[model samples]
Target: MAMSRNLTLLFYVTLLLIVLTTNQAESLSSQLSQPQSQSGHSMYGATQGSLNPQACGPRCTMRCSATAYKKPCLFFCNKCCAKCLCVPPGTFGNKQLCPCYNNWKTKRGGPKCP
Candidate 1:
């Protein structure tokens, strides 16, 4: 009877270990797959390259603006006129002009530039 009990306890322990290990693996995988955040935008990583232009959000428009200090700046436009401009995270720019861009670079590995 004692031997049986011991064997049963060992079985339960093995089962518990398997369950714990599986749970841990799943959690780790989920973390790896999840997108990192940068300047209120999702940042996959440096290896993933720049974010798509469409992903930049509705208020912003990314283009090669002559008025922008940076070659490519996120322009806030209203109809025909551009109200504001901001550089991407990886690119360099001033605090006043590229607030979001600066934030993205500091937080994420690279800017959400397209």
Candidate 2:
């Protein structure tokens, strides 16, 4: 009889532990899936990201390295990356990162970047 009681107690303890661990894992995954930012607009603005240079690097490089137009290319690319929070792939032509940066037009209706 004493052995049966100990077994029942151990079973309940194991069940409680499983329940607690499952709940904790679900909570952690939910937190990870959402993006977080401090500033209300511009930096992240529900579309772009904050001042994450690492995230902006590839996009900026792809854009700025494509041509002899160095100063303006980097300037505009960085500005767009800051606002859009992404850059496309190659060094010549790709707008996959941020469509806002891609579809954006110049005053004369020309492509803005090199």
Candidate 3:
């Protein structure tokens, strides 16, 4: 009886480990299969691939006008715009149009875009 109980416990533990490991592997594979950028856009290719151009205009305009850092600004703006779908107007000091964009944060927890 003691031996049987020990065997049953071991079997259950082994089964549980297998199930947990399989779940973890599936999760990791799903994450790997999807290509994403820090700015929350799917990294399809160059030129902000697969984004709707219409939604990018406001953020692009704002970022273009606000920063001397053209390349990085554009990249950040496009990413924010892709997610938020709207950009606050003017060169600086207005973010009411898209609350989500305005509130976005970088990985380091700072403001994501200008």
Say which candidate scores most in lDDT: 3
Q: Lowest lDDT 10-mer window, candidate 1?
A: 76-85
Tens digit of per-residue lDDT, candidate 3, span 48-108: 2234667576547655875778787778877887776555556664665456777899889
lDDT of 1 by residue, 15-112 (tens): 99999999999987866664557563434222122344344443233333334543334332211112113233333233333344333442457644
- The best-first sequence of candidates by TM-score reads 3, 2, 1
Q: How accurate locally is residue 27 in candidate 1, as Cα lDDT from 0 to 100?
A: 84
lDDT of 2 by residue, 6-56 (tens): 999999999999999999999887655545546422222223343366666
Evaluate model 3: give its TM-score.
Answer: 0.47
Off by over 4 Å in 3: 1-52, 55-59
Tell me each candidate's TM-score.
Answer: 0.34, 0.47, 0.47
TM-score of 1: 0.34
- lDDT of all predictions: 0.43, 0.64, 0.67
> What's the lDDT of the predicted structure labeled candidate 2?
0.64
lDDT winner between candidates 2 and 3: 3
